[model samples]
Target: MTKRIRRLTAALLAAALLAGCGGSDSGSNTASYDAVAEESLALASGGTESALLPDTATGESAQKIIYRADLYMESTDFDAAQDTLLDAVDAAGAWLEYSYQSGSAKEQDRRVEYTVRVPVENYSAFLEQAGQAGSVLNLSENAEDVTSEYIDVDARITSLEAQRDRLNELAAQAETTADLLEIENQLSNVQYQLESYTQQMRALEGKITYSTVDISLEEVAVLTPTGVTFGARLADAFGGGWRMFVDFVQGLVLTLVYLWPLLVIAAVVVGVVLVQRRKHPRPPKPPKPGKKAPAPPAQYGLPDAPAANAPPQSGKPDAPKNPDAPQDAPAAPAETPEPPKPKY
Candidate 1:
């Protein structure tokens, strides 16, 4: 009984080993845990080797990203900028892909553009250098991660290769020519699929290793009025000023022509004022200094003049009887003094 139990254990171990050998090739890229768990389950159930999907890869392989950039820029000198771009491309181990130019050198809006494929490691460096060649108007960059597609393609190729091996084995065992032909046809179809997958993977790898760049260049020159020189501008300023002065005089004359009736009314008013001033001229003011005026004649009906032969009164002059009377009105008479009061 002890020997029989030992033999049973050895047989079971041999079966598990055989299953591992069969699954190992298909599961080589799979995670270790999945492979181990699958093997254990197959061992317990006494099943044949199980083909596995790529284990849910918790850890990713190296990233595969296709990078692209677009740059738009203006240059002071298009020729020089183009030359600098080429040199920068070579320096960064990149290659020019395409270029185009529109318009003649004599045209103001002439444009030039370039495209390049730069090494992945040098992508940023090359981009910075390209921008330095001119004034960068716009820069855009994109990254497309091809890692999932890349892995899937790789996995598909692995599956196809395994299938091709089985087809080849079956072809080798064919007995008749018709059977061999059928197997060859199937093998050919499988080969074609594998080749297609391989080509796709190769393209993805190429793009991952090298990034693409598109640069558009334009030539710009400072713009001014038709005549650009300082001397021309100064001459224009002086001419404009003279023209403005002439326009001002013309406008003034035109305004007066349009308002002629109003102007005439104003002129007549001024003329009337001057005529009235002349017609009603005022008297001259008396002299201010040094003259004595004559006394008014007496109002008591006294003789304005003494008799020419009459003797003159001596001592003080006689006082007028009506001193406060208006010079032009006569006053009441007063009697003369009686002879001189009889002298006694």
Candidate 2:
């Protein structure tokens, strides 16, 4: 009887050991390197082997793509063109995402920049229309294929959700506080990952649904396509000249601003020269001759002045008179005596 009892005990112990080995071999382990195996483990732990995920893997998950464009253009009338573009956007069922306007030279030029979001169906047509809003100086288009990345994210979210469910199950079964706390920490991490992935997916979907376009509008004093109305022409005729003059003045000021260094050098050189001049002064110049002395008082009465070209003298070789000969009336006494006798 004792031997039979021992044999029964040994058989029972062997059966129990075989059952434990079989269970360990058949059970799914989340720690497995294979992703599918890990997911199976999680499903087992969560007791939700048939749990369903959202319809991300269906038609809703088309080839994920991001579309964008950049447009630089000139407008005839800034305000009018902007209004026209806005109206067109409404017509096309697009929305203005944002806008900005600034000036490189407020007096000369300004720039208007904006971002618009349009349905993918209307994206190309909207670009064409917006391009016509003005003379397109620049047009650029871009495309990004994110299908692979999106798939990756979606799979990650699904896995994380499964993990969270399994962790929740573990938490419920946890006997000790430490075990519960560890499970909660893992749940938190999984939840965080799920949230981040969901946000990214939403953003990507938004981009796919509505293509983005960045536009830059420029306002310039000239080269606009606006018509020349009589009034506008007249105003422009005058205003153009005025603006040109203003530009000239502005350019002059800018030139001065830029050339200040040259001007300063010139000024210093001039100052140095002036200082040197003051230190060593120049001598005064001598006076100049005024006029020739008047001709010697008319020669003592000659009956008449000789002509410059008159023949020199009658051929008589007269004797030269002495320079000391008396010039006073000669022999006046002899003549007076004769005249007194004739009168008596």
Candidate 3:
């Protein structure tokens, strides 16, 4: 009976060992299979695939294109051309995002710049219509394909949204205050990213839906020649030179107009200076070289007459007079000689 019990126990031990080994192997296989299945499922659903991958089921996704155009044009009749351009815009169902008009009819440099937004469907038609409004000086177009970028942004948005939902669930099931707070923080971050990505997506959509066109319309006296011939070039050169001369004259006139106040002030100053000079005349200058100076005038006065009470003078010497007799005759005294008459 003891031997039988031992045999039974060994059998049971061997069976238990075999069962344990088999169970471990099965568990490993199941684990590997589950891993492979998860990977296959992820690939089938495109969950782990690159966002830039082209869609296979739909053949290919529609291209996301952002179109922009720049047009520089000139027109002789500015007002009429402007009217035409506006009509075209209205016809195309486009709106002017920005518009600026400068220079006036008097200036002869009337210019209008328009930043127009047109529906993508009307982009080509609008360009054709706008070109008709004026002579095209320059035209440029750009088409940007944003398919990959669009897909990337969209995928990121979807991921962030899913993460937000998961975080919300986690927050609700959180056991501890700290855990709940952490999940809420993650949730907030996910929400913020989602909002940012959504905004970006909307902006991109707007750009794709509505193409932008920048138009510059300038008033010109002559249309630019489209030909590359020498004659055309010569004509253009002549026209440009003439226009330059006219512009210079116009600029000078405008400058004078703007400085009229200063001109008036300067004129007043000059007039005042002239009047002051006239009021205060300068002294006469010296005689010129080789010219004689005027002589002084002679003075006129009466000549001195002979002294009064003088003896009579003769040509011959006086004879010796008797002292006594002479005294008696001298007493009568010589007649006073008359003074010489004054000359006029």
Which candidate has the highest lDDT of all? 3
Rank list by lDDT: 3, 1, 2
Off by over 4 Å in 3: 1-59, 228-344
Runs in model 2 deviating more than 4 A are 1-61, 103-108, 221-344
Could you tell me which 10 consecutive residues in candidate 1 have the lowest summed lDDT? 18-27
- The digit string of per-residue lDDT tens for model 2 on 204-320 reads 789989999999887655553445468766875786598678778989999999999999999999999999999999887545678665565776667776899998888789899
Cα displacement (angstroms), candidate 1, residue 11, comes to 28
> Which model, 2 or 3, shows the larger TM-score?
3
Estimate, for each residue in 163-263, the C-alpha lDDT of model 3 and write its tens digit. Answer: 45545655666667766666665566657667877888899999999999999999977777785679877987896698779879999999999999999
Q: After superposition, how far is residue 275 of candidate 3 from its true place, in Å?
A: 25
Q: Best candidate, TM-score-wise? A: 3
TM-score each candidate: 0.49, 0.49, 0.53
lDDT scores of the candidates, listed in order: 0.68, 0.65, 0.70
Backbone clashes in each candidate structure, one number apiece? Answer: 0, 0, 0
TM-score of 1: 0.49
